[model samples]
Target: MLSQLQKKLLNDFQQDFPLSPAPYADIAKTLGVSEQEVLSALQELKQLDFISRIGPVFPPNSLGNSMLVAMSVPEEQLQTVAEIINQFQEVNHNYHRENRFNLWFVLIGNNQNHLHAVISEIESETGFPAMRLPMIANYFINLGFELDWND
Candidate 1:
């Protein structure tokens, strides 16, 4: 169960997140709370797994190179392989799929070379070949939606 302030933080600030120098402070001002309260709530939200991450979302290949990479890992090794891949700072997110390419993640790098290097490092560390699936098309989907607090 989440408190009202936690619910508000999750629902209200999904989009138009404060972009000022002290964004959390700005949010606290709007929410009638201290900046420490806002930061503590956010930390709790993350610890509870209500949010995976909070940051900017750049278009594919807009600021840097990015590619969707997949790996076929044995079921028993899935967790270990996923953790190994997550060690890379370039990896944005990784998830499991019910298919041969069960492990999939997006890697963003400064350039093509950096992208491939990270991929190679991941393969070497995990001992699994990565299938690079470059984005051929772009789609626009608003990631933010109103959270039903009542539920």
Candidate 2:
């Protein structure tokens, strides 16, 4: 279970992680806590596996091109296909969505051609066609959800 302070800190931190050389210091000032405390809280959260990462969410065009791809992987070959897709440097996230296209992943590349090449390679290696869904535009919405620590 998280202490009240820790919970408050987490709730606030999600909205904005400081963009300073010393982000902890900035967060500390805002939360009325010491910089060490901020760092310690984040470390503790990581230890508990409540937070997977504490980093920036880069804008798509700022870095490279990316697409959401789904593939219909056989149950027996799911692991193999996942491993093959994960080997690509452009693939950032992969998961098993609940649908016909069970294996889903994100492919990010230096350019559109690079993204296409990576997808083609995965298809050739896995013998599964990847359905690509590229985001044309994004509408910002807060994706925050409350965690039930008590449960």
The candidate scoring highest on lDDT is 1
Strongest candidate by TM-score? 2
What pairs collide in candidate 1?
Answer: none
RMSD of 2: 2.4
lDDT string, candidate 1, 33-120, tens digits: 9999999999999999998788887667888888999999999999999999999999999999999999999998888888999899
- Deviating ranges (above 4 Å) for candidate 2: 20-23, 141-151
Worst 10 residues of 1 by lDDT: 142-151
Instruction: Please give each candidate's TM-score.
Output: 0.64, 0.82
Residue-level lDDT tens digits of model 2 in 1-151: 7877678766777767778899889888887889998888888988998787887667775698889999998888899889988998889999988888899899887888888888989889989998989888988666566656565
Stretches of candidate 1 exceeding 4 Å from the true structure = 19-57, 76-89, 120-128, 141-143
Instruction: List per-candidate RMSD values in Å.
Output: 4.0, 2.4
- CA error at residue 118 for candidate 2, angstroms: 1.2
